[model samples]
Target: MGQKKKEIIKSFLLTLAAIFIMFIILFPVYYIFTVSIKPAATLATTKIELIPRNVTLDAYREVLFGFKGSKISKNFTGTIEGQAKIEDGKLYLTDGKITGAIKYGPFTGLKFEIPVSGIIFDVSTTENFQGTLKGEIEGLFVLTRMNDDGSIGFGIVREVELTSGDVNGVSVSGPMEKYVVIRNTGKAEFTAVGKFLNSVFFGYLKNSLLLATLTVLLSMIFVVPAAYAFSRMQFFSRDHILYFYLMFTQVAGGLGIAGLIALYGMIVKLGLYDKLPVLSFIYAAGSVPFNTWLLKGYIDSISPDFDEAALVDGASYLQIIRYVLLPMALPGIATVAIFAFIGGWTEFILASLLLTEKNQPLSVWIYLLMGGIGRGIDWSYFAAAALLFALPVFVMFMLAQNYIRSGLTVGGLKE
Candidate 1:
């Protein structure tokens, strides 16, 4: 009974530990997502918010498609006049007339007299009325239903362009902005930015994909054969060589800036600087030692009887590796593939140093978005891009969780 109680207590503690760990892991993701959805104005607040206020998709929209700003096109401008009247909570412009010159395009400074109507407003309150202007000259408008004297109405033209009308038996209309007053006039304001596909972000995405794919392909191609040979072959000094190779992984990051400088010098000397393929090769080469050791350990767990049987059955070593080992070593291979892809995708320093603007990946481009000294960072856009950048890796990890677990464990254990 005591043992069972102890086991129960242990299970509860383990569960609590897992929850704590998961919270630590996932909190940043939640924070990033919240920040991505928050409005730009709210990003600088000192208070921490697990749930962001003023949530909007503007950041995502801006990142995916650039902010196409709003401006009055110089090509289009005009004026119109009419009698405005209000009845039963609705405002109507009666006998509206476009009296003067409409400028730009085919109608450049051309005089046109046109009878129009239907600038109607659905008056809901004292402040403003929702309205549309439809006639020989058509538009949408928002206007104050009540004037000071309750006679003249004032509003800006929401749209008054490209309406077909006959001027001396000529069908004519160009894109035009106009202001109309039923006895008096004023201006209305609308603020919105247009959107266009962000080619720059997509370009970075393409380079990142290319770099990651090439890195995976190169890493797998080299690591598999090397790992298989190390697991199967009994060549002299093989253990010494493998250990020597594995030692580099521990010291690789420890080399710091000095190491990067040396690497840069080597690249320049070899004439391999600024080449993405060379960068991919470098990434693959850096990871090969650890990947080879991991995969070899995995392969060692497989029985050697299969290799002998294949040899006796007239199958070559290549065929045995292809037909037998590869099929069984998929989990380890997947682990290696994931490692290679992530290394390629997220290695910012090497990418920044080795690649030019034309080949810069998302990782480096995102860093550039931070803006240099004294310029403040746009956290909303940054968060959106970061969330998008991490999504693929997160999805891959989730999908391959079981394979990764199996591959990382049950290796280096020989009975």
Candidate 2:
């Protein structure tokens, strides 16, 4: 065989292998996307489906917005069965029962009954009196000035809780509020209100975004100056300090459950538990030593002649770092920022250990979904949520792909 023909065959074989490896790597992502689009009911089938069947965005919908059945009832009428008394210029109602009919659009005439205690209203001779509901449906209510016939106008200004009870044949729950109006003879009307987004999912997304953003900012703030100092300045024990940072990188890998336990105890003692900003700081701290070293190397790869030139021009050290080094080290900085973001965005163990439900990030929530392993796992919803969770990191990598490549490679060439 000719040498060129052999080379062509070798090239073909390498291309085939590359395609195969690419397929192997990307199949799981493709499968996850398919699972996200597939209907929940279809995910339970025994057959392996390479192609999704019965595609529906219901999972994504549920992940972004809560259940589709959530509704707000506009018309509710009830009677107040307790007497109102004035104390300290405030009107109070105790041991009251509000029994009424609520109409939630298509779901009409639902029985609305709630026990009320210590409901308070501010006394006002003109305009309206503002009151607060403290029962199952808690909110502020406003009563307009009495008309000439002695009837009062009323409406709810704000409600804080979702009503949990059976409304006619339907179960009412999850992120719904109520608006109420009180009329003559203790008759009150309520309008049910609903929030659109799924609080849990959005909360997790928000926490992740916040944590990632803070990690990047804090990491940059802490890492860049230290890295620049290490790269540029020489003082006593400078090498020793750099070695210690390198040593910490290795030691950190060995810190397992014991370190986490210690961290948990310390966080609880310091009253910093469940705080996302604190978590961000922790994430930034964890990335610092390695990132400082990495960035230092990238900075080192840039000739020190730039620093000398800037100095010759009467530029201060800070000015040299700002004007001379940073612009050139952007790739390294981006690389560090990306690392910090990924660390904060994807950290499950520390987040789970330190954060309560309300403060937990998406990673913690996704890990908790594994609790449904033995039980019926909602693969569709899980897939959708997981995909959404991974998107920010994926986007960061794609956006900074070139910088990351250069940052990781060029750093090693110099140091």
In angstroms, give how far residue 53 of model 1 lies from its true place: 2.7
Local distance difference test, per candidate? Answer: 0.70, 0.70
Assess candidate 2 and give its TM-score to the true structure.
0.71
Off by over 4 Å in 1: 1-10, 41-43, 67-198, 372-375
Off by over 4 Å in 2: 41-46, 67-198
TM-score of each: 0.66, 0.71
Per-residue alpha-carbon lDDT of candidate 2 for residues 293-374, written as tens digits (9 for 90 to 100):
9999899899999999999999998898889888999999989989988998998888888889878899999888768764
Q: Per-residue lDDT tens digits of candidate 1, residues 143-227?
A: 3332343222433344665354332232334343245444343322222221222235666888999999999999999999999
Cα-based lDDT at residue 29, candidate 1: 88
The stretch of ten residues in a row with the least summed lDDT in candidate 1 is: 189-198
Q: Which candidate is the best by TM-score?
A: 2
